[model samples]
Target: MSRTLMSLVVLIVAVYLALCAALFFFQRSLIYFPQPSAVNSADSRLKLAMPDADVWVSTHERVGARALIYFGGNAEDVSRNVPEFAAAFPDYALYFLHYRGFGGSGGSPSEEAIAEDALALFDQVYASHPQIAVVGRSLGSGVAVRLASQRPVQNLILVTPYNSLEEVAVKQYPWVPVKWLLKDRYESGKYAAHLRVPALLLAASDDEVIARDSTQRLLENFPNGVATLKIVPDSGHNSISERREYWRWMGDVLNR
Candidate 1:
């Protein structure tokens, strides 16, 4: 065979092997990320809202208080953040939602499944506490926006949010043809554009995972005055909430 032909054959084989390796090692790419069960606090605030699915939720009760439903990022153990959320909004009843396949929740994770779970959890919280707010961070922002657009959310807060997973996938894998392969289309941009409730959009100026432009786009797409934008200074994707200003803004949003 010609030398060029042999090299072409070797190149194809190498590319094939690389693709297989990526599929094997990055299985989490197939679905939303999941966190292992953490040692929950002995606070005994959690209960199974979805009995068959074993979805665990931690609720902080405050009489006549507005209920806040929290949708955490893909990698976050949402229920584990209950203590912090509880501290942040002492007046509101806080509900930390554990997405499907995370914590004690059963089944696998998908964009639709998480959205469904968010709706169910929202309904559960709304049953007793009529006034409700929704807080979603990163990927959870998609879930929250979808819920808010359809449900009766009094207030909406999004932290380090993105336009969509498809947008992010294209940014990271420019040549991979990810639009076809990506099953989870957590498309917040579309829903956020039309959200009628009061909203707060928090973006980290230096967020690496969810680009600054994506967050900016999502915020800009929001309805006028229906949303307020806060750019957290010197913060990145995971550490945006580490700032004092973030907490201050969060306090103001919840109080509003």
Candidate 2:
């Protein structure tokens, strides 16, 4: 090769190495967005004791035997979910987990850590109410699916869920080797096969983030008759809960 051509090749290789190193080191920052722990006016906060970290929870207190535990999106402050959860399930007590590093919870967020925190929280809540439902939206769906697979969840609701973060990451960064670089895979599909309880998948008709096929693929991963798929009309991934009939459907899931 000519000297100029050889020099160009060396530069390209060096740049590619630098990019891969950055992706390997800082990929968690790209994956998990830790938002400030903002509390809503209607929320009453509680701290659940975990071995390594303390998890903050937003609650809509209602004296009842049935309860609902909700996990929010990556950037979502779970406190905001209180009002809607209250309106949707008036009779059931509500608990929304503010994930680690988000919403004033202690420690950095990771798939393994959050999964452990979820199991601990579920065990504590299950102590009071034997009949409990788990609801997860977007990123939280991964955590919730893993929780249900291990625990005795009465009901499971996944909104705008993807099969795995790897799949979603691959969709967004086709050129990058996301499958190998991603640390917290959050492979909900892996846990779906083991979950035996009734699951309701709320898919958006026009999801700009998670594709329709991504959510459908996760639903298909579940065993026969284990999960039911519902599409919210004229809705996107974030706006699926904004549909007029959304609460009615969600209420039915909790009430079941």
Candidate 3:
């Protein structure tokens, strides 16, 4: 090879390595986009005191045996779901967790930290509401699936869920080594095998974010007859909630 061509090859390799290094160091920032809570009233908030940080839960208190716990998308403000959820599930108490560093919660978010916080929330909720149903959307789906696997949840609902964060990352950055670089891999499929309760995997017919195959892969992970997949017509990943069928399916799952 000519001296000039050798130098050009070296330069290209250096630039590629630098880019990979940057991705490895700051991947979490790209993954989590925290948003402020919409409902900030005292009555609607529940402060959960963890050992390291204080996590906030948007709640609708109802005196009953049933309850629903929700985990929202990476950029979603779970507080926004309060009014609709309250009206839709009148008999069930509702708890929508504001993940660490999201809303007014303290500390940074990671897969492990959020999982611990979820377990704590489930323990607290399960004490009063024996029949607890859990719902997780987008990124929160990973948190919800892992929680249901470990706890005795009555029902599980996953919206626009992926088989694994690593798999999604691989597709997004085909040139980069996502499997090795990713620190917080929310592998929902691995945990789904352990879930014994009934689960509903809700997918959008035109979801632009989470690929349809990813949702199908997660469904395959569950035990036979444990999970069912339903599609909401004419909806995208972010707009799935706007469709009436979405809520109807969720209601059917929670009621069953």
Better of 1 and 3 by TM-score: 3
The residue-by-residue lDDT of candidate 3 on 1-256, one tens digit each, is 9999999999999999999999999999999998888889999899999999999999999988999999999999999998999888888999999999998999999999999999999999899999999999999999999999999999999999999999889888999989789999999999998888999999999998899999999999999999999999999999999999999999887765
- Candidate lDDT values, in order: 0.80, 0.86, 0.94
The candidate maximizing lDDT is: 3
Worst 10 residues of 3 by lDDT: 247-256
- Residue 139 Cα positional deviation in candidate 3, in Å, after optimal superposition: 0.4
In model 3, residue pairs whose N, Cα or C atoms come closer than 3 Å (at least 3 residues apart or on different chains), thus clashing, are: none
How far does residue 38 in candidate 2 sit from its true spot (Å)? Answer: 2.9
Predicted structure 1, TM vs. truth: 0.88
lDDT of 2 by residue, 156-231 (tens): 9999999999999998888788777889999999999887899999888889999888888899899999999888
Which consecutive 10 residues in model 2 have the weakest lDDT in total?
Answer: 34-43
| Model 3 stretches with alpha carbons more than 4 Å out | none
Give every collision pair in model 1: none
- Scored by Cα lDDT, where does model 3 land? 0.94
Query: Candidates' TM-scores?
Result: 0.88, 0.95, 0.98
How many residue pairs clash per model? 0, 1, 0
lDDT of 1 at 95: 81
Ranking by TM-score: 3, 2, 1
lDDT per residue (tens digit) for residues 1-256 in model 1: 9999999999998997788568545645554677865746646346555535667666676777498898888888876677777788887888887777787678777777777777788887778888998999888888999999989998999998888888988897776766666667788889987888989889988888988788878877888878888899999888888888888998887876
